[model samples]
Target: MIKNLLFDFGDVFINLDKKAPEQALAKMGIRTIDEEMTTWHNTYEKGLITSDQLIENYLKKFPQLTALSFQQAWNSIILDFPQERLDWIIELAKSKKYRLLLLSNTNDLHIEQVIKNMGAVRYSQFQNCFERFYLSQQINLRKPDLEIYDFVLRKDDLLANETLFIDDTILNTAAASSMGIHTWHLEPGFEDVTQLFEVKKALF
Candidate 1:
């Protein structure tokens, strides 16, 4: 039986424009996201580098852009958190059917944007619904890495077989599945998190 529900924040619950950041960067004259940029982004998400350091790196590389502009472009990926999804999660939490945990691969700047867009009260309500809310930057762990999945399972003393992890990225879900955890790689347009029970009925 699925006793724990592990959910990803982006695309699963909150809406995200996956291509927005790159598009925004393109507008700033940085047309393609190179390997160096990807490394820096991953490092930031893993909390290995501070936000200041990240901005510094970018500013150093593309001297044409200001810190404010770079930050704005970076944060453009975050969109909005829908009300119905929040309501569903809140109701699900109240039901006490499973231990709800939120695990997201996100950095500080993006999280700040999420809070600003969601408003403090709504964000708090959504957070309150989860037993443990884990952010990649805060936890020093990012998805698609086996260590992260191991860390979560060990920290919570959760059994892989009894926990269901839902994420938008196939790489993340595949990593979790490799460790014996059940996962649903939810498609953004076709699949919504509110349909969890119906979609994965057999697991429930």
Candidate 2:
């Protein structure tokens, strides 16, 4: 039986315009996100680089872009956290039906934006619903990496078979599944987390 619920923050709980950042950057003359840019982003997500270092790297690459502008463009991907989804998770937590955990591949800047968008009270409520909240930058690990999944399972002493991992990204769910963890690759518009029990009824 599924005894633990592992959820991804973005797209699963909160909505994200995945292409917003790229479009925002394009307006600032950063028409292309090159290999180096992607590497910096990945490194930032893993906490290998500080937020200041990330901003500096971008500023160095595009001399015309200011730190404020770059940060604005980078944070454009974050969107609203719907009230109904928050209500559902809060209710689920109250039931204590499963061990709740949140694992997200997120960086400092994005988190700041999330707080700004979600508001402090709502964010705190959402956070309190989880037993353990793991952010990629804070944990020094990221999704799609086997080590990260192993770390979570080992740290929590959770059985892969009993933990149901929910994420909007196929790549992340696929990685977790490879390690024998149950997963739901929830499609954004077609699937809502509130219907977890109905969608994965057999597991429940």
Candidate 3:
């Protein structure tokens, strides 16, 4: 039986414009993110680098864009959380049937933007629903990485087969599944997290 539930924050709980960063950068005349940029971004998500380092790196490559402008472009991917999803999770927490955990690959700039978008009151309510909240930037670990999944499992003393991991990204879910965790790879737009009971009836 699934006694523990691990959820991805982006798309699964809150809405995210996956392509917003590229679009935001494009508007600034940078059409593409090269391999080096991709490495930098991943490093930032892993908390291996600081925000100032990222800004300095970007400034070196694109002298035209200021630190503030780059930060705005970087944080463009975050969007609002729907109230219905919040209600569902809050209800689920009230039941106290399963251990709830939130895991996300997020950075400082984006997290700040999330607080601003979600409002302090609502964000606190959403956070209180979870037993543990792990953000990549804060944890120094990221999804799609077996080590990170192992850390969560070990830290929580959770059995892999008894845990269900839900994420919008196929890569993340696949990694979790390989570790013997049950998973739901939620499809954006077509599938909503609020319909968890209806969608994964067998699990319940």
Candidate 4:
């Protein structure tokens, strides 16, 4: 009865090292990421602040760090997009069994790195599989916020009961589930999106 499928881009499709950014920044003398830093990150994710502004803010704090170095640290979290997951989504799109959508809490820099890592051609192919692609930076909305979920459901005219949201983060999944949307909080190493059918068989 699941008529629509909403997927989180990071771990569900592409692999991400969530700690890489923090580790990368630590090397640049940002040993402790304070509340202000986290707030800036959230603001940046919501598109309230531009990447240049973020860089400038960080530069004001750490004048010694170069823009290129800061950019690399900021983008270190993005990793590979597995071909099998891409193939699975493409095949699923061909079936037309459900309305496919991609909802990612991502910023411009990360997205740039993602495209660079996947290659433009392959990234385009992956994007072609989705009916709509919502990136947090572009939409100015982020996950774990009810508004983002509501926006997608309302805009798509999708029934929460008939939609399945797949994400790697429990907080995100829990938020969606509270709104009556089914979710698969896929664990990174143990769960592969290519095995969606076998894994979330109850939803199908």
Q: Give RMSD to native, each candidate.
A: 0.7, 0.7, 0.8, 0.7
lDDT of 3: 0.94
lDDT (Cα, tens digit) per residue for candidate 3, span 1-204:
989999999999989998988998999999989999999989999999999999999999999899999989888889989999999999999999999999999988888899999998999999999999999988888889999999999999999999999999999999999999999999999999988878988988
For each candidate in the order shown, give its overall lDDT on alpha carbons.
0.95, 0.96, 0.94, 0.93
Question: Which residue pairs in candidate 3 have backbone atoms (N, alpha carbon, C) closer than 3 angstroms, thus clashing?
Answer: none
Q: lDDT by residue for model 1 over 15-42, one digit each (tens)?
A: 9999988898888889988899899999
TM agreement with the true structure for every prediction? 0.98, 0.99, 0.98, 0.98
Candidate that would win on lDDT = 2
Q: Kindly provide the TM-score of model 1 when superposed on the true structure, using C-alpha atoms.
A: 0.98
Q: Candidate 4 residues 1-204, lDDT tens each?
A: 889999999988999999998898888778999999989999999999999999999999999788999999988888999888888999999999889999999998999999999999999999999999999998899999999999999999999999999999999999999999999999999988888889889878
* Backbone collision tally, model 2: 0
Where model 2 places Cα greater than 4 Å from the true spot, the runs are none
183: Cα error in model 2, Å = 0.5
True-vs-predicted CA distance for residue 116, candidate 2, Å: 0.8
